[model samples]
Target: MTELLSPTLGGAAAGLGVAMPMGAMSVLLLQEAMRHRRTAMAAAAGIAAVDLAYAALATGLGPWVASHIAPVEAWVRLASALILLGIAAHGLRTGWTAPTPPAAEPRGPATPTPPAFEERGPGRSPGRPAPPAPSGPARPAKAFARYVGLTAVNPTTALYFAALTTAQGASLATGAAGAAFLVGVGAASLLWQQALVAVGALAGARISDTARVWTFRLGYGLVAAYAIKIAFPLPTPG
Candidate 1:
């Protein structure tokens, strides 16, 4: 019990620490939350899923994975940077474009209705006001898949977990201890991501549409800057 508890707690702490950094993924998550809370949560789940998988891999096979990744770390970083830049470019493009207006109803529909009878759709009644239409489909599933792919491409995640496993001297722990650790990591990261999402949602509720657009632009700008930094990182002092 003690052994399992130790790894679990350690993993939780590590997960929080790693997730606290405001990387491109973080920016994207916040932008998503501001627009669609449900989609943001889905993206958060994706991030946590990747984090959990990485934690498990690191705990069980850190040395081997790290060794293999070391050979192409630069290429991986470059690829990640390119992907981020592409996402940022897309965001900027969409943000600048005017929203499409709803199309006019077709002219051929002229069904006669009785004066006394009211047409009520599902989950709606005669007295109650109709619920506001959704601005767009939440598309949470698509967001989940996109975020999962984005987070998976980030080499730093795997490397960071691998480093932690090596430092903790638990890289070979693949039994109950590792499982507990992974659960802790997933829970902690998910909680943190959700907290971020909540904050963004609240801010979105208070802001104007113009403000939201500017905020979205700022997020993509930050992501672009991060990508540039990753593509050409500063040299460390000797």
Candidate 2:
């Protein structure tokens, strides 16, 4: 059996190398994390699961898949590009049309404070502010489905790994090596994604209206650019 350390480290580094770049999926994941942490975590885990599966497939059956599914892969890439473009347009429209929060109503003297300090519940604090309520219900299933769909159909991920496996030349000894690689990749993905979640939690209070608007715009623009790149291909020799 191949040692775990080498494969784990190599796999982690390889996974990060592929995943660290900001892409449509990354943006969506981050946005979800910022919007709803628990659901985003589920979605992130789903994406990691897809990555592990892909890594195994690439390691075990790279050549056969690449040979038999070249045209299908091309179509998937085009479809992904179109999807990205649609998401970008939606983001832009949403940012432009987001509604302002309703104004707070004025308090009147008729509102009476009947309870004294002695009557307060054991767990309740008199002066401390209550924690903000959850924004809304979480859609973990839908989010997970979207994450899985994007990852399963992403051509860039397939192409990138195919290239990587080809370059590595099946240097792996057996399925054990592939398993180790997947473990490492999954660990790294969990670490990075959780880190993003932490950052989102920490920064949730500090993000301003202007910053939020611009962030959406930046994400939309990047997605649009990626779509354009895919839609307009470079000339190839016959």
User: Best by TM-score, which number?
Assistant: 1
Using alpha carbons, what is the TM-score of model 2? 0.52
Quote the lDDT for 96 in model 1: 46
Give per-residue CA lDDT, model 2, range 43-105, as digits (tens).
777777776777777767653544555555444445545665665565566454544222211
Runs with alpha carbons beyond 4 Å of true place in candidate 1: 63-138, 170-174, 205-238
| Per-structure clash totals for the candidates | 0, 0
Candidate 2 Cα misplacement greater than 4 A, ranges: 63-137, 205-238
Candidate 1 lDDT (Cα, 0 to 1)? 0.57
Against the true structure, candidate 2 has what lDDT? Answer: 0.52
lDDT of 1 by residue, 37-150 (tens): 899899889888888888878777753543466645455556656765665565556444433222212222321111121111111112322222223326999878877776
